[model samples]
Target: MRSSVKALREQGVWSVEFTEAQYDLLVRSMVTFLAIEKERFARVVTVGPRAEELDAIISGAERVHGGKAVIRTSLDDIHMIHSMLVFLPTLFTSEEDFVTRVGFFKENVAEVAAGLKRAIVRTAVDV
Candidate 1:
């Protein structure tokens, strides 16, 4: 399952097949990765202060400014992680234990396509 998650991660975890056990592993791995990322973000946002108060006072705003820049640079990753870890789980439906929809399409696209094949037929004229 770890390997599967790693594969999904390496390939970009837009979609993948997962059993209950694999889902658990994926969630754990994602949460762990996101935690590590959050921690790294926190660590990276800090600016070193000079030992002397004179220098420290002068550079304190630099730290805040740097943090703002870092936050702007990282907001997308943070939002993506947050959506995956927090908002995603709450959307579990009664029929489906999990959802595969993220951006454009469902993760279980093969199944979806198969189900809709007849309805989604192509005509002589192309788009």
Candidate 2:
């Protein structure tokens, strides 16, 4: 996924398939990636359980900003992650813009990453 993000910066599109379990991790990774690379991924699309939570965060942010975040979601765990990378490059130019775009979502990004990481690890162990 990090590679995809890097490549996306050079090119404009990237899409990768992930299992439903990997999709869960992808959501967390994307959130963390967005937070750290906020300048690069200002606009984003997230999917999975975490994505639903992000939708609420974005909705609240939209209310406060008086403008909508350029984010979209499918609520499907795997598809969201796949589509997100494909959609990411179209949203921002640099990581700074990505961070700025995170806005209020920053508060929840850490918590979500931690939870998703645990879930991903546990799932991996079980499988």
Candidate 3:
């Protein structure tokens, strides 16, 4: 799935078809994954920086899960979410790795979750 998305991105194709139901499932799955990551992170690093960033990512995912935020039904968004999910596990190999890679992790989450709140307003106006 990751390679397929990368290929699509390389081809400059940003559109993908996903029913609203599928989008809902995707968001829920993402939230679940992040929640699991939180647990792993806590175990790996009892106290550390970037913890708040993880919390913020979870909050963003929760907002989207609860329909308080809207996700643009774009393939790029799907790719990003998938990429984050895939990348998160790599951080758990060691504490040092997690610390070093967390900034990148948070960046990806923020980028993927960015503007989700604004999407809700735009969608409502369109409707």
Task: Give the top-scoring candidate (TM-score).
Answer: 3
Candidate 3 least-lDDT 10 residues: 1-10
In model 1, the runs with Cα more than 4 Å from the true position are: 1-15, 39-127
Overall local distance difference test of candidate 1: 0.29
The TM-scores, one per candidate, come to: 0.22, 0.25, 0.28
Top lDDT model = 3
Off by over 4 Å in 3: 1-13, 39-127
RMSD in Å for model 2: 14.5
Model 1 agreement with the true structure over 7-111: per-residue lDDT tens digits: 112222122223344334334434433344344443233211211221222122112222221111122332243233333333444324444332212233223
Q: Rank order by TM-score, top first?
A: 3, 2, 1
Cα lDDT tens digits, model 2, 30-66, are 5644554343233332343354354343332211132
Instruction: Report lDDT per candidate.
Output: 0.29, 0.37, 0.39
Which segments of candidate 2 are over 4 A away from where they belong?
Answer: 1-90, 104-118, 121-127
